[model samples]
Target: MTRGTTNPNRLRRVDRWMAWALGDLLRRSESAPVVVDLGYGASPVTVLELAGRLRAVREDVRLVGVEIDPERVARGEAVADPPRVEFALGGFEVPVPDGARPSVVRAFNVLRQYAEEDTPGAWARVVGRLAAGGVLVDGTCDEIGRLATWVDVWAAGSGTSRAGVGPGRGGVGPANAPVPHSLTLSWRLAGLETPSVIAERLPKVLIHRNVPGEGVHALMNALDRAWAVQAPLASYGARQRFVATARSLRDEGWPVLHGPARWRLGEISVAWEAVAPR
Candidate 1:
């Protein structure tokens, strides 16, 4: 019942990241898990795009795009390739064939309508559907996919907490409650401005926390400062400026997770603690 406002390649940023970040997991799944694209909107292009990108990483990758609306599901099924890219009707249930759990449940923009406090329960539901070593990516993005952010959630001992980020250190919720392993920010660097623009599109949990006196707010401010100070590198292109800004944030005690390799792609990941709400 979520708004299905989607378009072709709208999720290209995250999909590209997945191809590199979780490609290995998909390759090693051994037929145990499927990749689910939850709530693919009115269009199935993104779903088709997901299959294309993921298949390049794992030729035999099993992929499914799920939506609570049966109409959308039917639409997706029309153009899907059988046995590989498929569509299903599901909500947070994250249904898969033969009761198979998913290795990665990518629920983007599906929870934007829910209350912030509802995130934990909804997240737990999605994570519960994950197979061993599974990951749930709860995220949001702009319509055209220019700016985006997502939180990576994993089961205990899955060792899926990656991109150089780990729990605690301010990333994990107090009392050791389940929290995001890493927070990722991505953008189309050409015609880019300051990095703080991503604050508007952060995952639901941190979206409202971008105001003054909030941890996420402070983090965005710091990034803006760093991005400004690194203006000299703009001559080399936004990529270099972004890489320098990332290094600056790290040097300032921010637990930035990804390195220049990712930063150069207009992406930066951070341990959740570095900006988790106080």
Candidate 2:
């Protein structure tokens, strides 16, 4: 059995990130989106809590808690809400009844124990099950869900155009247009020692690639240096120091995502290229 260590409100950070990043998608969907809380551990509290938060955005959101262990699934069923939220027995295959495909799958802290080589197969299994224009959030976080990182996967052959499209293609033609793909790396920065320390808990895909020559390694090193340069701001507090450090990195072309709003929360996100394996 997998370690089922979990706590109430432990996944708040990741949940909040989801709301901010995917809220538009949730609100725009014509039909209610089905969400899978994959591998929700021992208790169903996290699934229950996630349903509450997601429903705040979309009143019609449906949630399903899946566990590989049948006993765990039974336990989840015992605690789950009847229709809006349910429980099932399954692994990465993400078995769904009525031949339904989920719009979103939040698989947090599920693949940390697997061999690195097995990650792609596992990711493919879940991503393949997502509906068109759907998303698969594959991630790992601390037991309490304070620090988290996830990759948002989209189905192939989905919408290529972004929200806003300007007339007259200046930079590149349709064929040369860069594919719309991204990986978001989020960190809770309370006294973060080195970005590489996160390697210990990385979702199986990138854990072993945190070596010296990898893209993740370079990004972490850059973060460490930026943090060191902002040591003077530490007198204000770690939060302020983190914000300043992030701004510095951004000015230096680090692909930092947002401004003080996200920074104040001790979080930073960069494009997948920032940490993709070399």
Best by TM-score: 1
RMSD of each: 2.8, 4.4
Residue 160: error of model 2 in Å? 8.3
**lDDT tens readout by residue for model 1, 95-177:** 87667788888989988888998898888788777876677888999988998899888765564433333342443343323
- Model 1 quality (TM-score): 0.92
**TM-score for each predicted model, relative to the true structure:** 0.92, 0.87
Question: Against the unseen true structure, what C-alpha lDDT does each candidate score?
Answer: 0.81, 0.73
Compute the lDDT of residue 174 as modeled in candidate 1. Answer: 32
Candidate 2 per-residue lDDT, tens place, 1-278, comes to 46887788888877887777666666767777788899988888888998999988898888899898887888888877756889988888897756578877898888778887777677667877876556677778877765677766555544422321111233222322222244445566766765556656665677778788887667677878888899888889888888898898899998777578888887777766677666
Query: Backbone collision count in every prediction?
Result: 3, 0
Pairs with steric clashes in candidate 2: none
